[model samples]
Target chain A: MTALAPLATLSRRRFQLTTRTPRELLVPLVTPMLFALVIAPALKEALHTGTAYEAFVAVGTVGLLVPLNTMFSGLSVIVDRENGAQRELLAAPVPRSFLVLGNLSVALAVTAFQVVALILFALARGIDFHTGAAGLGWFVGAGVLFAIGMYGMAETLANRVPKQEEYIARVPAIAIVPWFLAGALFPITALPGFLTWVARFLPLTHGLALMRYGLLGDASGLEHIWSMGSNTAMAALSLGVVAVFAAALTAVSIRVFARTALR
Target chain B: MIEVRQLRKVYPGDVEAVKGIDFEVAPGEIFGLLGPNGAGKSTTIGMLTTTIRPSGGSARVGGFDVAENPLAARRVSSVVFQEPVVDRSLSGRTNLELHARLWRVEPGVARQRIAELSDALGVADLLDRAVGDYSGGERRRLEIARALVSEPRVLFLDEPTVGLDPRIRHELLEVIGRLRAGTDLTILLTTHYLDEAERLCDRIAVMHEGRIVALDHPQRLRHELGRELVELHVRDDLPAALAVLRAHGIPAEDAFSVGSTLTVPLRDLSAGEAIATINDLGVATAISAREPTLDDVYLRLTGDRLAPAA
Candidate 1:
C-alpha cells in the first residue's frame, strides 16, 4: 500500500497541474466543440456521407478530438520534464508503474467527459441508438480505451520532441487525421482503393467502426464488436487491442523519458 | 549520509558532463560542490539527486542506491533546483501543497510542515499571493521552504543564491544555517560563490571539467595548498614577475595575470618573506597578503581563477 501511495500522489499532482489554470481546459473542450458545431457541418457534403451529417459528424468529430486532446494534454508531461517537475515526481518513493498508469488515467478522464458530451448531444439531436443500453455501454467503454491508447501515443511524442511546436505540428496529424482516413465521417468503401487498404492498418478505424455501429446500427456488423460477435468476445477483443497498444506505447514512452532524463 | 562513487554522465555526441567524481558526506555536514561555469556541478547534483541518471558509476543516499532504488533514495532527499520550478499562477502555499502530495505526506502533517518551513524561510506572510508576485529572492526562499516540507534526510541545493543581492544572499544563507542546525539534515550544495561555500559548507569539493580535483574540510583544503596568495599591483610585465618567482624555486602554479594586478601564489613562506621576494624583483609598488581562502584552493586545483566569464 505504501508503494502504491506514490502512484496515487502522482495522479493527484498530474491532475492538479493539468488544471492549474482554468484556461488549460479551454483548448481541449472548445476545439472539439468548434469542429463539431462549425467546421464539421460545413464539410458534410465534402465528406460525401448521406447520414444525418450534423449528428454523424458531431459523434465522429468528438471521437477525433479524443486523440487530439491526448496529444495536446500530454504536452504537459514535456513541460514538466523541462521545468523539472517530472524530476520531482520521479524522485518520490513511488512505483514507476504507478506513475505511468496514473498519468494515462488522468488523460483518459479529461477527454472522456467531452467525448460523452458530444455523443449525448448527437443523441439529443435525433441520432438513433442501435444497440440500446448494451451498445451505449460499449460505446463509452471504447471511448475510454481509445483515450488510453492516444494518451500513450501522445506521451511518447512528448518524450521524443525537443520543442512544443514540433509536437503541436505533428501529433494532430498522426493521432486525429487517421480518424478521417478511417471513415469516421464517410465510409472508407467510398475512398480510393489505395486509402481503403491504408485504413485497414489504423486503430481508430476499428474504434470508430465499433462506435458508429453501436450508435447508428448502420455500419456493416462485421467490424463492430456488439453486433457481429457475442458481446463478451467483442468487449474482450476491443479491450485487448486497447491494452496491447497502451502497454506497448507506455513501454516506449518510459524508455524515451528515461533516456532524455539521463542525457 | 550521502555517498557518490565514480559517478559520470556523458551526453550525446560524447560530451562528458561528469567524469567519475567521488565523495562521501557525513550526516549533518554541509558539503559544497564548488566549480566555475560548465564545471559539471549541476550535472553531478542531477545524477546524485536522481533527476538525471548516471551513464557510469554509482551513488547512494542513506544507504539506498540512487540508481537501483531511486525512489527510496529520493524519499530521504529533496532538491531546491537552480531554476525556479514553482508554478507562477499558484499561491506559494498551493505550490508547496502540490509538492507535499508528491511525497505522500498526510494533508494535516503537510500543512504543519508547510507552516513551519514557510515561517523558517520567512515566506509565511506571503503564502496567499501568487508566486509571480514574489521577487526572485522570495521565490528562491519559497523553493527552499518547499524542499524542507518533507524534512528530507539529505538536502540538495544547486546554486541557491546565484543572481541574488548580497543582503538577501546573506539572509538566505543564515536561514540555511539555521535549518542545518535545527534539523539533522545532510546538505549537498553546488555554488560558484566561494564565500558561500566557505561560510556554509563544512567541507568543499573543487570540481574541474567534470572531475573532483580537490576535496576536504574548507580550512584543510586551504592549508593543504601550503601557500599565501599575494595580489600585487606592479608596473612590470606580469609574466616576468611570475617567471621570477618560479626561477626562485617558489611554485607559483596558482597564479594569473588579471588586469593591472598580478595575483600570485607564494609557497611555504610568511607574508614578510613573500613581500621581500617581490621587493627583490624591483617591480612591486604595492602588495597585500590576505588569508588563504577557497578561491586560492580553487586556483590551485583548476589552474584558473573564477574570473569574469571563466
Candidate 2:
C-alpha cells in the first residue's frame, strides 16, 4: 500500500491535469505538426536521402514535443509549491520520491500520446519504416526515456527557482535551448564544432538519433548517426545511454526535491 | 501525543526563527501557542509536522522522533497551514479524496471519513463546488476537512482563522469545538487572539521572541497576575490621582496612565478604596473594576498587546 501511494497520487493529478476539451488536445498536437510542416519542406532538398526529410522532421518534432510537454507538466510542481498545495503532500506520510514520481507520471503519459500521434501522422504522410512494429516499439521506448529525463530536469529547475517570475523567465531558456542544440531544428553536422560537441551530451540528441534509426533505418548521411555502425547496434546503444541518463536525472531530482521541499 | 524540547529553526541566513522552545501536549488536549506576529508560532508547528527541519533539539509525535523518523511522525500528525493550501482549481471533495489517498487510507474508509468530515465541518453542500468559487471561510473549512480525512492522531492548525471575518471565525471555532468533543485527536493551535486562546485552549503557551514566556491554563495565567483590573478615567491632574492612590498604600507600579486612562492591577483591594482614593484626590471623573483577563496577562508578560489596532 505504501509503495502504491505514488501511483494513487499520480492518478489524481493526471485526472486534474488531463485535457478536458478537443480544443485543448488540439493545441499540443497541432503545434508540433505545424513546426514539422513549416520546417520539413524547407530542409527536404538538403537532407533528403534514403528517408524523406518529412519523416526526419516529424521524428525530431516528436522528440521536441515530448520534452516540451514534460517540462510544462513538471512546472505544475512550481505552481503547487507557490499555492501551498505542495506543503500538504510534503507533510503526508508517503516517501518524498512518491511526489516526484507522481508528477512525472503525468508527463510520461502526455509524452507517450504525442509520440504515438506523431508516428501516425508521419505514416499518413507516406513515411516508410525499416521494421514497422519494431520501429514503433523503439519510438515508444525512446519517448518514455526522454520524457522522464526532461521531467527530472524540469523538477530540479522548479525546486531551484523559488519565485514564479524567476521560474517563468528562466525555464524557457533551460528547456528550449537544449532542443535547438539537440539537432531538432537542424542537422547536428550543420552546427559549429563546439555546438556539436555540446549537443552530443544532451539526452534529446540521443533520443532523436534513436528514433531516426528506428524509423528510417540508419540515415547516417543525414547526420542521424555519428559513426558507420549497424543500425540495430546504434539504436541499442542510444537507448541504453538515454536509460542511464534518465535514471541518473530521476535520482538527482528526487534528492533535490526532497531537500528543497522540506527546507 | 506531542513533545518538544528546545526546538529551534535557523534559516539559511543567520536568522533564528524559533530559538529553543519547549512544550508538551497530551492526548485530546487543545494546546494553544499564543504570540504576536513573527514570534515563531508557525515555525514551531512546521518543525513538529516534519515539513521543516529543526536546527537544534528534538521533537516527538506519537513517540516517533520528528527529525529522525519523519514518516512515522507524519503518519500520526496532520497540519493545516496558515496560508490557504487547498487547490483552488479542484473541487473540495476531490481535494479531500486526494489527501485521503496520499495518506494511504482505505477506499471505503476514505469515502466514509470524507463524508463525515464534510458533514461535521458544515461543508457538505459546498464539497462539490470548485474551491476557487468558495468564500475564504468555506475554503478554510474544506482545508480542515481535507486534513482530517487522514484520521491523524494529532492535528496542527496554524492560525486557522487568521484572515476570516469575525462571524466566520466564531463559526469555525465552534466546528473545532465539536471536532474535539467527537474525537480523541490532540490539537495544537496557534493564534494571537487572546480571547481565542482563553476560549478554546486547555493550556496556553505564550510565545515571545521564539521562547515560551508563560505556559499554563488561561485562567491560571491571568490569576497569577492579579484578581482584578481597575481603570480610572481622570478629568484633570492624572499624576495627582496616581499620587493619591500611591499615598493610600497602592503600589505606584500597579497604576499608570495609558493614553489618559489610568490603569491599575489590583490583587485584593476593594472598589470602595479605589473610589475613595480617587474622590480624595478630587481629580477623577469615573472608575471601573473588572476581572483579570488574558490580555492583562499578555501585557504583563510581554509588555506588548497581543493583537494590533484594527
lDDT by candidate, in order shown: 0.76, 0.80
Give one digit per residue, the lDDT tens place, for model 1 in B222-294: 8765657788886776666667777875556667655767676666767787788777877678888877777
Model 2 misplaced regions, further than 4 Å: A20-30, A42-51, A132-134, A219-233, B232-248, B252-262, B275-288, B304-310
lDDT of 1: 0.76
RMSD of 1: 3.6
Q: lDDT by residue for model 2 over B1-310, one digit each (tens)? A: 9999989999998889899988999999999999989889999999998889899999999899998999899988888999998777778888898888878889899999999889988899998888889999999999899989998999999999999999999999998877787679999999999998898999999988888999999988988747777777878666666666777776546454556676777777776676677677666677788887888777656653211210
Q: Please give the range of 10 consecutive residues that has the lowest summed lDDT in model 2 chain B.
A: B301-310
**Candidate 1 lDDT, A1-263, residue by residue in tens:** 36566666667766777787555565777767777766765686577654466656666776677887788777887777665456655656665556667877778777876677776765665655556886776677677767777887887788788888888889768776797787776677777888887875666766676666566654552253234445456545655665676667777877766666555
User: Where is model 1 chain A poorest over a 10-residue stretch in terms of lDDT?
Assistant: A220-229
Residue pairs in candidate 2 whose N, alpha carbon or C atoms collide under 3 angstroms: none
Candidate 2 per-residue lDDT over residues A1-263, each given as its tens digit: 76785567755665475552233244556668876665576577656643466766777788667766766666678778887478888888888888888878767776777767877777777776665788767766887887888889888888888776776687567667887888776678779998888887788888888777666764552245457456667777778878998998999999999899887
TM-score of chain A of 1: 0.84
Reported per model, the fraction of native interface contacts reproduced equals 0.56, 0.79
